[model samples]
Target: MWGRLWCLLLSVLTATAVPGPSPRRPSRELDATPRMTIPYEELSGTRHFKGPAQNYSTLLLEEASARLLVGARGALFSLNARDIGDGAHKEIHWEASPEMQSKCHQKGKNNQTECFNHVRLLQRLNATHLYACGTHAFQPLCAAIDAEAFTLPTSFEEGKEKCPYDPARGFTGLIIDGGLYTATRYEFRSIPDIRRSRHPHSLRTEEAPMHWLNDAEFVFSILVRESEASAVGDDDKVYYFFTERAAEEGSASFAQSRSSHRVARVARVCKGDLGGRKILQKKWTSFLKARLICHIPQYETLRGVCSLDADTSARTHFYAAFTLTTQWKTLEASAICRYDLTEVQAVFAGPYMEYQDGVRRWGRYEGGVPEPRPGSCITDSLRSQGYNSSQDLPSLVLDFVKLHPLMARPVVPTRGRPLLLKRSVRYTHLTGTPVTTPAGPTYDLLFLSTADGWIHKAVVLGSGMHIIEETQVFKKPQSVENLVISPKQHSLYVGAPSGVIQLPLSSCSRYRSCYDCILARDPCCGWDPSTHACMETTTATANRTALIQDIERGNRGCEGNRDTGPPPPPMKTRTVLRGDDVLLPCDQPSNLARASWRLNGSVGLSDGQGGYRVGVDGLLVTDTQPEHSGSYECFAEENGLRTLLTSYSLVGWPEPGPAKVPSASDPSVSSPGQLVLLRGRACRSRWPQCHRPLHGPCAGWS
Candidate 1:
């Protein structure tokens, strides 16, 4: 009973262990095969838009108010930050009036019309006020505007100074702190008996000295020192820098001489200080006089100087832009110089002198020369009222910011020297120029622009800098003269010859990461929403299972249809002689199976017996004679089955042996008498055999 119980338990366990049909094995159909398909989902709705219309001279962003201000040759426009669409943030709002346009142009076709050859500069002092200057109308002026209204000031204030001569030039201006500064060229009254020598080119005569700064001929650029506290007695200072020709040694060809020019000088004055009162009262002072050689001919009368803050860490340094002439040709270059107010004051205190060694020094005035002084600070006589010369000079200094070797550096000039981070590129486009920097740990982004319509971005990195990427942000090529990067949202604003452009840094990063992969119909290394990670399609394992199943099914079907046909006909038998040959007939009439023939009882020849051939006749026996006689049989085979014996035959010839003979013991043995006796031999039952005579004599009784 115990053994039987154990056997029953085993049977029950085996029945339960059948595993419930493996839960249908979850077919591979659920995991679809990976086939290459176009990624339409990734590329559905990218947007592009038309940029601004006119070229721009300056770009400023009021982050607090969400407003963008752009300045062009003779126009200033505003844009609301909220109005910016995808790639369409550069729409224009308003333009400067004809009266304001005239200020930018230097050469006018008509008396009352504004000049087209205008030198215009723009700066934003605050959200509501922007300072602009031009050589048109031949006078320097400043105005305040409402940011929301986009309208110019109804009230105008004239500048303190009168227009200097050198009638064909323009002016550039800047706003630093609360003051406005400009760079311009002013002409001097002719001196009698100082006859200018005649040169080969029929040039105008008069030994007038040309300097970067003079009471009559100079422009100033300004910036607010937000990091520094405003002092009680010091005035808000604006700075100016330019290049000029050094004094000639007795007029030997100023053009032929190698060291004929220098980076002239820089001057600073209070915002309220202007004209002759502040200038003639000796209120303005000269800073560093750059001794480096420069070209004087290219910048003799008309030129440009620009300045910007260097680094965000410290605001003490500044960068200046100027044109340097090499071998009589003008090449635009920028200088990164260091300055301190204490160092400038030390030089001014000692240098009551006019000329340093034999080289002509600027900012000096001796009675009675026709040309403007090299570095003297000048202003309009009327605007200088109430300005005190005896007031203590403000300590305003500028310096260049240098970058470490490990840090990425900009390909173009920006600030003093841009810190250069990773993946930054200087790109030229139709909208405006931009310098882009990729996102990093400390800095959000860095941006820069150029006069040739380009924008570049760089990301800060510990090692060398990288140019992240670039894009065509505009429709046409425009001069991108100035640019500003917003601290609030890290957006880039560009000033072009046409207008202003604003680009969000976030948009740039997205475009760079997915643009090409989405376009080329390739598998994207992109974030997967379901998995929340980058994933790749599994192709290898999927293909292996599919291939194996297909091969197995194909093999099973081929074997099932192998042998399902009818039987074939028999093959004819053939016979052959020893010394000669005989013919063996092996005829088959069926096309389904082959036929085979056997000689005697042994397995012999077979032909066309496997359904491969039809209408096979017989086998040939060449030269058949005595020994070529035998029993033959025929059979057929078809498909996988074979026929036993369809035909049989025997080949025969006349036998040459004795049929009858007598024994020698008989009475006839006494004599040579022939005896007749019967002897029998059996042949195959199906065919005939012949009985015939023997060749030699036989002793027998008849």
Candidate 2:
């Protein structure tokens, strides 16, 4: 049966493969051809293919293995680069069955009702191993998809302990050195009562058992050191960025006033002691205390943090992204701050060394400096003032200055300051770029995902210098919580609302790799002996609109209707008005809610009542006067929503006058016989000659 299935799949692939240019078209020859400079028409003979219609929430790329992992709305697909572009990429090597059934199925429950597992984060451990986390599937899991057999290996392990809560909040994953680490939404007991807890705290904790992941606390974000030796030494640390209520404060106290709410924190655990069978026994040491600072206190909601290499010269320097609500601007904006881990450690230790009175040293112990607070290290005095322990307090220090010991005093230089980079919009989470410089200068690139479905790429050009790039990868607006990049393949994997998109660095103009080679027709396009494959350049024709259209077509098939004519015309309306009552007539059907009534373009009637009552009978004006003899527009609003407005002018006044009486004889004239006749003395002349005619008498009467 398996052999027959394999044969059927092969036959399907062969039938789909049509004769055309080879899938691996030479980039050099394609670039050499004269291309149109026009914005819309640039390529020729382009072939387009659509992947499965599933909406992906996360994307992961494995460079060493040359594989792309796309995590969609409820299913997962592994696609090869050779089968991605053109019509030839119709092959889907593997796919996770759509999670349609309820986790714990019961009788009478619909099994195919789509219990979607929205995959949010993906981390590549090695060439074959892959780790992924999803919402429906609350457990942390790792799977090895066989490259040759196109089947997932039976290596699923439940990560329920690490990711204890639903992923609706946010989560991120990083593969530092050998062990896989993830920063996920965790539930923990509130601080005051050890037995009964109310509110959950967002705390940074390691994957180890009892220490951080215990029922007492939850982790917000985690970072693992990439170096093997560093992974084992003091340098090999896992930093957790989270927000938790102060240990001493109660819920009522913190909740009474918004300012006393939960504060941001960082905790670190040494990697050396984290990976053994006794993992749960290890304890996490406190590193730094950071609070959400914003001008508007109410808008501040502690989300999550991302750690990035501050300067290219050293990997030890790190920066963090935090979300805060402030009145100074919109609540949706996010603020970021930079802190040297070494300096954070010092501040965490308090002003212990500063108040060196000799008699009683604050931080000094009888045994000698009680294990220099976990995150503290001695630095210049100016750098120390930048730390803010209060939630509403903003850091006074603008930037950090590196001082030289050779000088008599601390030399503060503004050129190389380490500070947090600010962004206009708020982002729920941030992911550090995976590029690390061991021997020479390091390149700092940080990826941030916004709540409005955008991926922001930030690169530290130098000390206190940065560049930001934003790209829209999702059609519908959905929150982008996590992001990951594969340095080996130079591809950016973004986790968005529906699914993931693999953005090749070659597509970015800054990289100057494939795009530049393609434009210049250089030898950079051919296959390289090292990778034994053609240089991959994503054609511009592969766009969201095309993909959406293909998906829609596949779903609708040939019976789909096509629009061939212009839209219908708008409806017409008429208005009528009386003394104080106005009638508005609408001819078109509508679903509008609220209608606005404007009188002579001056006073307008809305939800507020002034001198008018509006209803289905039209607008009713209580008192009628001559002054009100102007154009009165009556607007009808069903609900609070806006609707079509129509108006009529009552430009006349009521007057008193005699009433008209009808006549039966002469319909046109009434009471015409009421005229009085007078006879004048001149009529005496006419009396003698009445038969002669009344001309003389009429002359006298005239």
Candidate 3:
């Protein structure tokens, strides 16, 4: 719900944001929300008198103990990730004091989830400790809690710059080596600041406009990365992803009256760049950033927070979710894009964006380069080149770094095309685990959450994607706030306005037949010939090298399950009066078939005799006669290939005897060409004089 409200609130900024470069044409040729037969089981979490909205604040997952730590208004609860069934885990109360709660209420915040001290931040500090922060009634406070004991220590750490004063404030932080790197608003939430705490002379980047950040919306992730290519003495770095307004461009090509436009961006800071000796002392000198290009083809920039995940390798591959926006700042479609961490580094190594007065444009630097490039890793080679430390950099280079912190190159996705695209649906979160078939082939099985409280499971095979299923997570239409998977990746934890539900990632048993099971292409499942059903063959405890090795992705050997042995017995006949139409039942599942009717046995039924009309429901024989009795068969086809479905036979009722006969020559009798009416049936059986079609008082028969 918070994610939805944020989308609506962004409309207020539409009238002010200036439009930028046109978006690229989206390369996705097909988009779909595949209806899946996948199943899920919902479990309950800790509930309170104030209701479940409190549980919607923050959810952090720890895999070792299968414990999910939830931070809410004045409370901290832990639920077992495997199943949050009734009374699964007890909640630990850590709300603000009575005075703080009342103070927040007096400040005009809602008394329920807002006015109370909401635990807004939670990060793993160590094996036994968890660092957390709460919006203490509009005043931020931080504390270290004992994870094993579930108790807060006596010492309350100062939370300034670490936790936001409001629950909805744009904030992001990462913990490494007992230190916190945070990017948030400072000086009463007006100026954006990036800071590093937990050390002497803590390094803090200068305020926004003075640095790189602008009016950013939200932060997705704070990734700590180390490159194998790093030279000796290079420290790992911390990177942040968010959407910020473009820096002021006084280029002559564009209009000066244009409003500020939002751009997806990535900024990073070195872990060892303590500070400058005099100029930027106690500040980060290695702070640098670049633009991230993630617009929908033919659409504008991407907006809002997306789930950030990575695949392991030499250079990590990041898979992120994004919603496309128009020039007007309204969100319309969603896409999932992949990025390599190596790309981010490449952009940082490029030129800095600087204003060129002579050319009247912001272009690549034509000026002399620094001995050691600004923001470059402090490797031994770079250090030997007269750049012993950040302090040794000349004022000209530092000034250029300060004035133009943006990179010349923009970060592009690894693949030119997005893996999945959804039009008219907001895809909020995405998380995937790599699955290896027994045959040693690997693929990504993605689980994406929608704005309408549904989760979609899809697998990308070759150039095509199969949407396995769409399962409802929330009972009502509430947006998924956050999603996380258990350590083993078998269980999914979805956060909603209600409570978190632990859903099994794969439902192998739901696929009853071998055809459906093999067609699933789910890495966790395989069709077992002995059991004749889908089974969870991929397991952490078992050697899956063989179980998933020869994956039947082509769905081979499923023909035996199709029952091609013989056609069903001839259908039973239905009695109908002469001159009456026949109704045949052609049963099938909804939208799963296109029925084609054919005359199996000819009793001389055709257009010249009396053919059939196909209605939205079933097949209808136009006219019925004793000679019209024949076999009518229906076949269904899906994707491809046609199969016999059902059949029906029509047998006409014998003509009545002389005393009870209905005269066909009677003017009141209905003809076979006329519509069947209940009155006509009665006239034919009881009122023999009016048995014929009711033409002009039955004068012809008279």
Candidate 4:
């Protein structure tokens, strides 16, 4: 009975087919801080300017002389540009008077802290004098400082609208012809004032009717191009940016559904405005406003966070930092948007809207327009007609202009797309510098600061934007109040409540490998072959320069290794006892990419494949035996490029407590929080990181 002998032999083979460890998958681990970083130690060679590290809210840089001015609670400092954060920086202490402090304390304000003198505005008054304003215990005050002596050499002036009563209030202003121009709440937050805060000229605000402002939250201001010698027809203009709620007067619409939503807006006033002839005296006759658009199609919104000034040379471009969030919350993501001057001019030059009497609505004007157009600045032609200011215009024309100061149209962004956007980081302040690369291409280097004391260095690319690097600016988490960039010094100055940090534009030396250095995509960085390290020098040979590609993947950038993927990692071994469990990690880098695995030239492990199973931690093998012994490999696939991770060999059984396997997702992928899940590495329902530890299907990693 040869057939009986054959059946018996087959049964023997089955008896020896020992299973691997039962699949006891480890829990997924998470990575919270995965961004590449430059520690503070590298910046040791510096002359640092040190302040009290308390609420340095205002930052002003006189770029012409490289002098930096910082305004803080009860003190103002003038720091050397070269050694800005150095301890020996010059400071002038000017606190609130005893009587003013008492008044603030009576108002329920913190006298020792919040009720002190906080400088809110500091601008160049003249070549030798500086204009500074402070919230003197809720009683605003202004003073003139002598630049030569760095001291406040003049007595304080009563500054109601020139400075905000609350140090935390949002406002913007500029000094023009020795006059302070501002859009702010005059004496209290309830009375919003858009006025020229100068002696002998007074203009107050009304809370209703015309409603020229909606308690405008001011951001920044820029003076229109005005060179005394040149004779231009139009009067100089100063524009301010803010966000306010829409009403029937004019806006996207006074939609009942969007009663709580607010729209970003920009308003401008003529420099030579002298109020109206009879009805509106000492007021801005040319004050007009329009909406700022940075909305997306999916009902997503981008609200202005801050703005950079416009170019005086007809460049017609204005830059602003906006955060994209749910239309209701508006804080999900942040981006940089550009506004065109052409759009501003178009809205101003378009048809005006009128307030309908009985209907209580703002409707497009179909009636006759006032002569020379309402809000038209005093041009050479108007001057020739003997009209020096709005005081010369007829009363009817002035009244019409006042009622219809809001533009009928809105100013949409130059394009719907953003120059730069970040979903992971909440940007507070942003400044950019344009520089030409040695490779013959030019790009803007954006220095964006965050709320948690981090600065993200990014560069604009043709396809999109890439965050090149990030650095910590403070010892603790603090919002970056201001960011200033200096191209001449190749540095970025960051101001926070804790202190100021100066950072280099590039840190090429940190990248030791040629592959990593080129993948950074920083305009200031390039690969140099002379020293073998990632040198900062711009010199690069044509052949070596061509090696860089696909920066988002950090691939295709090594000599003779120009493939789209990286080679498989080196191999290791693991010993498992019979009937024991083991994990084969498959998490690679790039959460954007998924992972897969191959075993002993067999198909992917799945049900019906014995006790072997795929998990987020690694491949878990239960009841190990001789058949479980084989070669196993882990690979990471991202951006359509497949990268080899690591390989391992499973041999004979060993004395076991747990299978000598690690619970960690490999750190090879360079992503933080959690490594990419290897073949069996899986993400649980609650764990997005897929990097937590799994104790036993019953134990922990050995």
Candidate 5:
């Protein structure tokens, strides 16, 4: 009895001491490959418009005339949106004066890159004019452009608060209700500012940099209207997305580092704000901000953002691209997270965070909140109480808002984690479009541009996100500055330092067989049984019911429908000396499929089994002997379906002399001599015993 009691006690103690399972950590990345990769040379449908100017950062789509307005350094071009490179484009050269350039160069700036008229802001001022701003050799200038003739007026407005003096500084603006709302840096060393221009009574952020805006790097801004279903009448609001340095240590909900750490944020202000009456005169009174959490522990820096605003404000969603800064980890990775507009609004309606003077840290406000709610837009209820605008708000409410601009609760993502995460790729910009499938479900098609000049086309699924394909848009790797999508034309316009590229959103012609088409899982494509080809299922295509589409499950096979396709390419024979290493090539069928090798009739190339290993592109065999002289076949398995991808015939002969193993430096060896790194469940389970370390062990495994 004593022994049994002692054993039970020990077991209970062990169970109590061990920590419960931690909350599920955010996914590092989705384990899948693009189904197809089309190089720049094979992309015949893509059109490009190149020019001598650089940094084509700003792009505005004019759907009225089917024109794409490109804002480049010292020039602006109007190209046909349907075909950007079809013919000659209208261009206007607007260079800064020599005196301005001299002054810019005298300030110790690089004349080649920095001292130039880089057009930064471009918006439609009206139906026939465009509001343009540029860094004219360190002197900011804004002017109106004649859209018909592509001509600039002689007079210009002083772009002090409308644009940034340095072309490299972060800036973003939008024109709404004849007012230009802009967020940019004021001067060379000043803190970032958000203000309204081209308005009768323009409001700006408070002068308190630490509490208002601290070293913010703006990415995107947009206007959102209230839904008509709501009972309360509210004003439309403008929201800005950016990354700023933390004002206090551990201020954000998920923050675990120092105060200097940067955090992604979303701030909003009402459009009807008329500034405080006296205390905060000429300053916004309904400004509030909250932190945006992408993932835990790392990958927090915001790189870029895009929005899919629907007719109903509740259905609007914002997608953001994030990466790990050098302060956290040194990996070239990026992640995409999405948030609903209602979730964001809920956070602002929650408790407010205030800096505690006693502890020198930020904490939730414990005092009573002012009436009408601090940082609330003017509503019908406020109007009934004799408050018409922000200027009519009481001083007590304004004082509370001035000190408590940060919200206590952070806005979490829609699915509680990132939609898509990728490693070894840095997404510079992204845009999304909604596509309704024949199955009565709508999927978002995301076009992500990487820093290496590749565009990844991915579709959001009920389970997660899947990358359909990747295309090399540019021959030479260059960062994509702007990406736009035209829904009516079914096209995507990509702007980079080199030029603009116009490509169709759907490439259904690339898939030859029903198996390939269904395996791609592209929402816009369907396998047509009549034509025996994969075709787009948009309204433009006929006979929609006859097309076979199984996006959720890609188990449909060619055997169930039409005749089997032509036989795969003939098997290739390779002759190798005994004791020599050889590599057999095989292409992957799709990213979701797994590849395995079969020798004769049995499975071969089991990891580290009999000197056989799997590589990224193919199978690698070492110490080749006559026993290996047999037919080898590669099979891709997905959704419990096995398909033959490639077949190889390996023949080995006795060596003339002593056999020598190939070294890394051997000129005759072409293989990389490295084994494939497993992903997903296998990789995670294998590394479960180890934790991420600052040095050695798992760090060197990769």
Candidate 6:
């Protein structure tokens, strides 16, 4: 009897053991850095709007009105979308009452940060007004704002299920027709829920022993109108993306299970899902969720999601940014995966997963599923079978749905892998824009924002993605909270903790030469033979026929003829005192190429042990001597072709006037020669215009 008891105990322990974490593999898809990095200070035409408080988290773009609405802590702002830097923005201050702050403090919350109002949800209610909600001193509240006046009344609606009580938690909502569908934690209860409000009969997830949403953190929600694109007259669906704890029985407790393994999920509910008359009253009857598989072993967590909807349903795609969760936050790598709408729909139509009561485990249901499908919308075929709405469904169907809300299959990403992968970078948000080239092909450009205040722009190709460039939007490290792309305005509005910044859609003029323009693989940029400049295709309407673009094969499209080999090298004269340090700027246009400095027609100054060293932005020459003076040229080599970027004539002079240096305390004592010398030493990276014909053609360099 003791041997039998020991065997039973061993079996139970073996069954309860959880699997270990998946092994990490090196990513070879994309580089961590982009081809070019432009600092925030070096960026031109960038607009900014500082928020009144912290957490500038939400943004709404009104394209028709040419305005952008920002929702921040204790305030809201309205800026001119075209030019936000004009400093003529409108503001409205909305803070919590003193009583609410006192109550929040009594409840053990921080009075300074947690007691203030934080706007979390902003949705368009009508043509003239917007529905906004905020965390009001740990009490959720919402109100309507007049678009023209940009003001709100004192009255508010209780926003328990519409918004999160804690500003730190994640929540998402979408307003379809007149109803608001939201995924958030129940106010003051901390229970994760998905519910629909503002309807005839409000519906919420079931409060059963099997929690439908297990410690979920919402990411994004969208409405997909299936009726418009379907021949079966299907009801519209509202889809939500989030990460939640997996439902697996183990030796760990409930709290440990929640923090142990997380699974990214995509759930959908019918827009017309009325409560069942007999079984599931005031609850969702047609709700089903599936795993969003991005990689093997499913170890990544969803960070952000964006959709690229096309005219056809088959062409529509959704891109998601996920980070490896097994490692620490700073060491995590991000993966970008693309999912087609059809694949997601197919998974929803597959088998269901059910929990076994006797075994206390979850697995694919072996029993026969109810007729007409449990989690199916009211399609034309279902209507023919005596099911007009969800309330008319049979009790057996509702009972099946209540027991099985998970799908047996998961929605795998396109190509069975991530499209782009980068280690040591955590992408917080992303947006996509489609650009049509002059060559009659369209390409999608993805803008990925990192937690470290950088935005990487990449173009999608047939096999993978190629990063065009990166721009530092903020001086300090901060996560990009929201991003929106406006093709009509030709700009990208980024929302962060600091403020909102407006960046141009394409910086084509930054590329100096035809070779650089063609090699960039930017779909929005093309070389114009008429003007001999790189110009944006949208604004280059004068000479469309003379435009050249080659995204697939790099610079091979510009082989036959060009204005000249390369631009005439811009030569500058620099004079520095002996023994003083000197810096020669040699900004490389392309990251794929190698840059080196050639002094006096030879490459001897780049040895690391000597005073000369090559840096990313320029070459630094320490302890400058008279022998260091020479004609220096910076060359970028790519595909065995050397291109001259810049040329500088360095001249060292003997110290004059008793070797007296300029003193910081004596501003008036500064001299013109000293000013010129300071200006020469302060090297700046800029695109040298080819319009100046000061030097001959760069024949050997090209």
Question: What overall lDDT goes with each candidate model?
Answer: 0.33, 0.37, 0.62, 0.63, 0.77, 0.77
lDDT tens readout by residue for model 1, 1-702:
534543443333223221122322221111111111112233222232224334465556677777666654445655565443344233322334566455444344343433321225445656565654333344434456655556667664443232222233334455444443444543224221100011111111112222223232243344434224433233334444443444422224443463644324444433433222222232223222322111122232213333334222133333222332234232222211223333332343222223334553323433332112212232332115432431222221110000000001111222112222111112221121122211111222333343344444433222212223333445565555555555454355655554555555433113111111121111112222232222222222222212111111111211222222223234333222222222333433223335666656685653333211112433333333444355555554533344443443434334345322234354433223211122221111211221112211111101
Question: 1-702 in candidate 6: lDDT tens per residue?
Answer: 544543443333223322323213223434335777788888977878885777888988889888888889988888899987788889889899999999999999999778989999888998888999999999989999888888897788998778888988878888888898999885776679999999997898876857888889999988877778689888888889999988744333433554567888999999999989978899999889998877633357899998887334657788899885432233456778888889899999998888888977777877898887998999899899888999999999999989899998878877666677676678999999888888788888999999888999988886468888889988887889899998888999998877888999889888877777787889889888778888999999767657878887666556664642367466766666776555566766677778777888885566454566576555666566788888988888754456787888887777664444334333432223222222222222211221112321111111
Tally clashing residue pairs in candidate 5.
0
Compare candidates 1 and 2 on TM-score and give the better one. Answer: 2
The TM-score between candidate 6 and the true structure equals 0.82
Scanning candidate 1 in windows of ten residues, the lowest lDDT window is: 398-407
Estimate the Cα RMSD of every predicted model relative to the unseen true structure.
36.5, 26.0, 9.8, 12.9, 8.9, 9.7
Native-to-model Cα distance after best TM-score fit, residue 64 in candidate 3, in Å? 1.7
Which run of 10 residues does model 3 get worst, by summed lDDT? 693-702
Regions more than 4 Å wrong, model 4: 1-50, 198-209, 224-236, 249-254, 257-261, 274-279, 296-309, 323-336, 380-396, 417-426, 439-441, 461-464, 469-472, 529-702
lDDT of 5 by residue, 52-82 (tens): 7878889999887898999999899999888
Quick one: best TM-score, which candidate?
5
What TM-scores do the predictions have? Answer: 0.41, 0.45, 0.76, 0.75, 0.85, 0.82
lDDT for position 528 in model 6: 87
Counting clashing residue pairs in each candidate, in order, gives 82, 22, 18, 53, 0, 0
Sort all candidates by lDDT, best to worst: 5, 6, 4, 3, 2, 1
**Model 4 poorest ten-residue lDDT run:** 23-32
Write down the TM-score for model 3.
0.76
lDDT, residue 65, candidate 6 = 85
Whose lDDT is higher: candidate 3's or candidate 5's?
Answer: 5
